[model samples]
Target: MTASLELPDRLAAYLQRSGVALAVSVCEGDAPLMFVNDAFTKLTGYTEDEVKGRNCRFLQGEGTSEEQRQPLHDFVHGLGEDSGRFPILNYRKDGSEFLNYVFMSRIRDSSDAVRYIIASQFDMTNAMQRSKIRQNDETLRTVLSDVEQMGREYGLAMMSSAQQLADSVAMMARLSLRDTR
Candidate 1:
């Protein structure tokens, strides 16, 4: 749905109570957080009182890289459209880290003025870990295949050398017999 349409109170409440994790921030000045749903708290481990009126950057920590923070920074400064699904390493209130996939969009009023920014965060730590495991497995398989190929080549070379040695020994024996005769 387009952000221009004002969400009714009931609809907003429904969103707050919905199963999805989301947070709404007023974009007037510092983009202070205005609302956070129950799911948001459950995901971040921070209560509404702790997060209200604060910038959501509190979720970022040492684990968050500058590259991941740049996109969100550019989006907030009106340098980009929507901040697409970007994965950010974020820390919870208890300092536990998780890969967060964040989607942010601007909500505008009828006059076309920006009113708020709605950000939805999804936990993707498990998916990212699985992807890494698959990549490692592929790398291991490639290494094993190369080693097996080298082994086969070495075996062929050794067999050829043994055949040449046997032929030389047989020729030497025949020459000795001819000399004795």
Candidate 2:
């Protein structure tokens, strides 16, 4: 086999053997699926044939906001040379949403002409979930601390005000009682 085929073949074989879920695409004029192993199909429920000639954007749906689309467009256009990463939430064919961390770069031939745009996607839903949990925990901790501090300050203010009121009442009662006696 030619080296071009051999390397990608070996890499695809290794990835399949390792059971890593990933999807790879190459884009020249239009994005095309160059290789997708069993894991990719298993993750997205799309057969290799179904995705071969399609742009990856079809995975997006009405739920996909412009906010998610603009950055990828900017990255692909801004870099010009061809390499960048953007994280996006995308839906599977079954409409299940997952966080995808996508890395894209251009592969150049010997003459350094712009050849292929290679993209690799990693499923980051679990990592993002963990990060969200940690952020929430930190936010809760800060709020609790603020509440505790406010409680202490409020308690001290109430005590000081009560003490002054009690002392004034006691003095008035003593003067009035003494004057009456």
Candidate 3:
């Protein structure tokens, strides 16, 4: 509520009520933050007024590696993949640092134009609840998504038997990659 947010009632309600720290940024310009929930403020020691309209990179000061930043940067620039997930060291407003696992998804409009990047970030330093289970779940989701993509590409090259068989596996990978939601 610290910033003037314009969103649908349902989306606003969900963002406000989410337990996980979440932030949303518009795709244009410096990708300035547009929305941050109370959980985000609590996790970063910054209130809405201080964080809104700023880039999330404010959380990075020293020790945040270029290796970790490159993947995310590529995602934003359309240089590599369509999504980004990585762990990086992030600083809080109080100068304290934490290992942050960031997951970002691009929200595309009906016409397939990306309008926003919604980020879900978690502080790994404090997360201790059966991470194996969570990791497994995430792995499965990634595999399924890959399988879905494989299928789409496979359908185009089913002419040769050996090629078809090889593509079938890739096509399977594509199908498995689908159903991201």
Q: Could you say which candidate leads in TM-score?
A: 3
Clashing pairs in 1: none
Give the candidates in order of lDDT, highest first. 3, 1, 2
lDDT for 2 in candidate 2 is 24
Local accuracy by lDDT, each model: 0.62, 0.52, 0.64
Give per-residue CA lDDT, model 1, range 64-132, as digits (tens): 999999988777766666334567999999999988877676655444566566776767777557886
- Higher lDDT: candidate 2 or 3? 3
Tens digit of per-residue lDDT, candidate 3, span 4-67: 2244444556556655577877777777888888988998999998987888889997889999
TM-score per candidate: 0.65, 0.57, 0.67
Going through the candidates in order, what is the number of backbone clashes in each?
A: 0, 0, 20
Give the C-alpha lDDT of model 1. Answer: 0.62
Alpha-carbon lDDT of model 2: 0.52
- Arrange candidates by TM-score, descending: 3, 1, 2
In model 2, which regions exceed 4 Å deviation?
A: 1-8, 11-18, 75-81, 128-181
Off by over 4 Å in 1: 1-8, 128-181
